[model samples]
Target chain A: MKRFSLNQATTRHWPLPDLVAGCAEAGVTGAGLWREDVQAYGVERAAALIRDAGMTVTSLCRGGFFQQSGWEEENRRAIDEAATLGAPALVLVSGGLPAGSRDIDAARAHVGEAIGRLVPYALDAGVQLAVEPLHPMFASDRCVVASLRQALDLAAPYPAETVGVVVDTYHLWWDDGVWDQIARAGRERRIACFQVADWVTPLPAGVLLGRGLPGTGCVELRRFREAVDAAGYTGPIEVEVFAEEVWARPGADVLREALAGYRSHVAELPAPVEEDDRAP
Target chain B: MKRFSLNQATTRHWPLPDLVAGCAEAGVTGAGLWREDVQAYGVERAAALIRDAGMTVTSLCRGGFFQQSGWEEENRRAIDEAATLGAPALVLVSGGLPAGSRDIDAARAHVGEAIGRLVPYALDAGVQLAVEPLHPMFASDRCVVASLRQALDLAAPYPAETVGVVVDTYHLWWDDGVWDQIARAGRERRIACFQVADWVTPLPAGVLLGRGLPGTGCVELRRFREAVDAAGYTGPIEVEVFAEEVWARPGADVLREALAGYRSHVAELPAPVEEDDRAP
Candidate 1:
């Protein structure tokens, strides 16, 4: 049976403790948490609450914003938080193009430099830095890692295990190179996590929060599952929606809906049948 | 000096005659026109008016809806219109993913097949087909040719003189693969037209109408010009904004702004430094 995890950010209206308690009641296997919540609750207390409720922490919310004043210090702090929280992956939203800079290549190079400085600390802390390539709409004000190929290239300079990428369908579905990039990432052993969400209509300015829950939009979820599975990634398929409407709903209701949507759309995906299995 | 061409869609609010008059007043050397306007003006009259005003028709607005219900007949008619207008290139907005279909690959194949069938007709009519890959945001409703690479691939099986691509900065700017794809298209002799517009903020559901006029947004226009020039594309850099607000402005104002922006941006670009120029 496939297990499910709900990113706590989806229930952002609720506090960490309440969100975790709701997840526990809903019988979710795990939760991906944001560092802001962890800091608010204190990392030690947050981890304790998760353990007390018997929930696995699949991932820490994020660490990368490596294009600002004091990015080195910020990244170090993020890695420290990831370590303290006992999370396997520290998701990195690579900072967007620096203000007033029209040079995307320069911004990308800045990201590479920042990540290079942070990789060793993250690896030492047993935290994998998962670079999340944002959609191109965010190319100016958000992450410069806009494609898996670009993310993989940035990760190439680091050890694959320590530096990886977050495969979020929302940011990447429009890209033609996605499948090829996924294949290349898999071949190079660079996939850190597989995140799923649907791309919905009426995209507004603040493009980050417009994602739909699974089964609510046009993505071919089954096909996406098949491609990732084919690429040798059998990790937790985390549900990470940022819908304002969904977040506005009660955390418990959101969790219930996410689970139901996940089960209906993802868990039922047909497994690839091998010839040997058929014979058996 | 590089010449400036006004893509009439930049002043979509204006009728054909008024747009031509505006462009001529603004000292634009050429105009990129759409089929609907041509139909409205009556094809022969539109061509005659453009000739009378002494404006070059750089490329016809569009021809491809090859993924929809009326693909064949529509494409044939588009060829006729392109021929009637004596358009240097008949821009093809390869239609989007069809209604009730998740098969983008099938739609793409259909586009390839449609182009294959239409190429000979286009050649016979002396109208070059320029495949225009719209921004990926329109992948579901407007165009499946979402990247220059994909457009180049679609054009590969056809002769460049018969079928090629339109490299519009608005569509191709977000693509990290763009520079390389443009270079390759140049090598293959497949760049049919070069268009310009800027990517901007605050994308609404009607974002199709929110495009920025040249030099009004974050795109590195001079850099784009350098790349186009480096690819041996010395054709007029056609300004093709689709902003509703810009269109709502008087047609004369739109043309004046577009030309001024184009001149300032293009003046900084290095002239052609390469030999392998794309065809058609």
Candidate 2:
């Protein structure tokens, strides 16, 4: 339960103050936040409120989109905000191919270089730059970094403390190579942030906000949690789902549901009885 | 032009009689057929129409879906249809996780064993089993096989002549590891089918009918063609798009556009000055 964190994305409409208050009442000590929500609330004020409520900002939502113009400044601001919030990591969603362009290799190379450029700034700010590999579906429009291996490889050139990779189950569960990569991410000391979200089908139009809460879909949430645990990751496991239905619910109810899902699907420590549920 | 094969999925509404006549008139010697269309037209009759038109049935649409009930018998029928159509390969889109199941590893393992079971039958029919790895977005609901590497790995245990992989640009384009895997596929003699489809953004609802004709989106079609060619596969380069806009157009007009897209975006011999369109 100590490791359970509710990423604000799971309840997107929850006001920051109310969310912090609700979480504190629920005994949830950690949160992962999105920049849009924080900015609207004033970063410094949000930081103070979170601090006052005794909640830890596990990681900042995003700071990538390197393919866009002015990305460096935008990310630098995000890093500063994360530092202010006392978050350890700033998750990056490296943007996809520039509009009307098709060179994915170049886009990926730029993401690596962009992260390298931010390493010194991140290190100075005491914020880790977490390179998040989005699902391959988002490779064309949202993020070009589409696999954990690619994320790890991008982070390899920089110091582990300054540049790390994110292991988000929703983006990675489909890859058979993810287990090996998660182990590799651990070996390299690059597991900066871990997010849990299930893969649901009939992806909505645009496929942007179709994620399911943990235990609601096909992802092996416990398997991912176990893999990260085996890889020596003892950090907060954030339930960072992005579904419209989740966002539409009362934040407290959604949080309760998320916690239950997390407990039943993710917090089980032992791995022996896993096959029992899968004997089809 | 000689190596160009139009997968019927591109202009899905084009009736078989008109499509074969259209291709023959355009000097297109090959086509990749879909099962639904063939069954509708009568398999033997469609086969005769293709043969009479002097067009080759480059491959069949699909025969996997190992997660479904009666997959073995269904796939056997698909193999027979491919054989009767004189197509040398039967493409398999391995189905996603069984309903209410989250054991992806088991689902993938099942795919391997299922393919192994079909190996003897496939070899007997003299038709290659081409395992097509769908994009990861479809991992939960459409196909569990989500990468070229996984597809090749699944195909590795069987004879390459009987089991090989499909490398479609739309599926493998986002993968940075695809180049190396393409080379590996060639060395391992596993490049069974090479499909071309650009990845358009704002994927349509359900994400199934969102592919673009060559040059219509962000995939490096010529690059994949060159990589596969370097890897020792001189097989037909099939343009296999599935877009609503494409289907709504007149078949001949769409075919002309597809041929032009293939010529400019995919069949280029030299790879110099490749970054012209990306000079952002």
Candidate 3:
């Protein structure tokens, strides 16, 4: 429960002020926020509101889309906003290929180079650039970084504190190689943020908003949590579903369900057996 | 043109006879058949129609859905139909997770065992069981074999002549490791069939029918054809695409467009630089 955090996206329709107050009232000490919401409410005001409510900003939703024109200026602004909000990590959804381009290998190389270019700004802002590997379905038009190995590799050239990877279960649960990659990220000290969401089927058109609340779909959430923990991560587990159905519910109601789902599915880390309990 | 094969699904609305006549008129010597269409038209009749037109069955559209009940009998019948149609390869789209189950690893293991069980039947029928790895987006409900590597691993335990893998560009283009895997498949002599389709986005709901014609989307179709050829696959390149818009068009019109797309994007495989033409 102490580690539970409500990502703003889980209750997207909730006002930032209401969301902050709701999290405080519900005993949630952490909240992952999105840049649009914070900027809409004024970054300074949103920061002060969360700070006043005795809650911490776990992360800032995004800062990458390297394929677009003017990405440099746009990402620099994002880094500034993260610093202003005192968010330690800025999630980077490396955008997909340039329009009409079929050169994915070149696109991936550009993402790595783009992140390298941003490392200095990210370090200066005291914010970690968290490279998120979107699901492979989005490889053509969303994010070219479609696997943890690719994300980790993209971040490898930078200082671990300046560039890291986001471990979001929704985007990664289908991969058989993720467990090993999570371990490697841990060994390299590159896991900046951990998010929880379930993989639901009959994915909606565009497939972006089809994520389910933990325990509501097919992902082995506990196994993922256990794997992240085994990989030496003790960060906040942000519940970050993006389903339209979830957002239509009352924010408070969604928060309660999110907490309940977290308790039932993610909070039950296996207890370490004492040496005395082992067979002789 | 000799290597061009129009998979029946590309012009799904076309009647079996019309599709055969259309392929014959277009100078295509190969046609990939779907089991449902073949069964509906009467397998023997469909075979005779294709054979009488001097066209060969490049491969059968499918034969695997191991997660469902009675899969053994169903797959056996599929193999027998492929044999009757003279399809040397029977492509397998292994079904997804059993209902309400989260054990993807188990589902994948079940696919391997199921293939092993069918190997004897496939060998006896002189048909290679080609495991078709669907894109990972279909990992939950459509197919559990979501990458060429997994399909190859499953095929590794059987004779290459009896077990092989399908190299479909639409399902595999996003994979950074696919080129190497195609080489490995060739080295193992397990390349049974090669399929070409472009990946278009703003994917429609259900996602099964969103594939684009070869030049209509972002996949490097020529690169994939080259990779498979370098991997030693000298087989028909089936232009297999599933799209609602495509199916709604006139069958002959679609076939002509498919042929044009194939010629522009896939059939331009590099010609052999003759020994006599090489610089002395």
DockQ of each: 0.38, 0.76, 0.78
> Residues A26-46, candidate 3, lDDT per residue (tens digit)?
999999999998888999999
TM-score of 1: 0.92
Categorize the docking of model 3.
Answer: medium
lDDT of 3 by residue, B1-280 (tens): 8899999999999998999888888888899999999999999999999999999999997888899999999999999999999999999999999999999999999999999999998989999999999999999898988889999999999999999999999999999989999999999999999999999999988788899988999999989988898988899999999999999999899989988898889876568899889969
Question: Cα deviation of B121 in candidate 2 (Å)?
Answer: 1.4
Docking class of 1: acceptable
DockQ-superior candidate, 2 or 3: 3
After superposition, which runs of candidate 1 have C-alpha atoms over 4 Å from their true positions? A268-280, B268-280
Q: Estimate each model's TM-score.
A: 0.92, 0.95, 0.96
Q: For this target, which candidate reaches the highest TM-score against the unseen true structure?
A: 3
| Residue A242 in candidate 1, Cα distance off native in Å | 1.4
Candidate 3 — which residues are off by over 4 angstroms?
A269-280, B269-280
Question: lDDT of candidate 2 vs native?
Answer: 0.92
Model 3 / residue A188 / CA error / Å: 0.7
User: What is model 2's DockQ versus the real complex?
Assistant: 0.76
iRMSD of all candidate structures: 2.1, 0.7, 0.7
Query: Residue by residue across B8-87, what tens digits does model 2's lDDT show?
Result: 99989999999999999999999999999999999999999999998999999889999999999999999999999999
